[model samples]
Target: MERETESRVYGWEPGEQAGRTVGREYAELVGGLLDGQLLDVTGWTAADRAGGVLLIADLGLYGPGGRADYAPDDDDAAGGLFRWRGDTA
Candidate 1:
């Protein structure tokens, strides 16, 4: 791409430049946390100084029935049951 066109997308405004390096590092760290070989799918894209990339990944598991179950909730927020056993955070 022409420098002019490239500049338009990756161009750093006055403040955005400061976060560029940090954001790239953070993305990498997140990608590293996942195990691609064990997982069903993994994807990545990146740019040089002007653009950023996102790592798309998934386990590719699903129920063919497409049925979901949920429990009723109480006002106290303690009575509700979680579907996922692990930490959502």
Candidate 2:
């Protein structure tokens, strides 16, 4: 059966000299955390820096949905629930 998934997208920007090195490191880190094989779904792109490479990664979490069922109040003094979620930092 199909299930709802949570998605987190991250952009890895490795400066001109070490794109390949950075890419391998990131793949290893994620593989270790999931304890499974990591597939290479990466695409080639240019970074903002001259001659840099950009790798975009999409991390998906699949399971029963509960976190998205509730919405946070955006009028909090601390600038909403996202503030603590690292969206502002």
Candidate 3:
């Protein structure tokens, strides 16, 4: 296996205290995502030692008009998510 010299993201630098089996796995996954061109991903922590949900304010490489001004679950039109607010909405 060759090291990908051209990897665009930062290398995985984990904290010194490896909490447990779950934490170590999470760290490895995050490292892979970052190396695979995940930009601006932050505040990622394992939830209850379970795999977490990924909320994207911007669709990014996933689709067109990729810049997200608000979170997908915000139910705001200005953010361009166009979530159904209510019957009046």
Poorest lDDT segment (10 consecutive residues) of candidate 2? 80-89
Tell me the tens digit of each residue's lDDT in model 2 across 24-79: 32121122112222222245222221122122222223232211111122444431
* Candidate maximizing lDDT: 3
Arranged by lDDT with the best first, the candidates are 3, 2, 1
The 10-residue segment with the lowest total lDDT in model 3: 80-89
Best by TM-score: 3
Error of 2 at 33 (Å): 6.1
Question: In angstroms, what RMSD does candidate 2 have relative to the true structure?
Answer: 16.3
For 10-38, candidate 1 gives per-residue lDDT tens digits of 22343433322312321111112221111
Question: Model 1: C-alpha RMSD to truth?
Answer: 17.4
| Candidate 3 stretches greater than 4 Å from native | 1-6, 10-35, 38-43, 48-62, 66-89
Model 1's alpha-carbon lDDT is: 0.22
Error of 2 at 54 (Å): 17
lDDT of each: 0.22, 0.23, 0.27
Model 1: colliding residue pairs: none
- Model 3, residue 67: what's the lDDT? 28
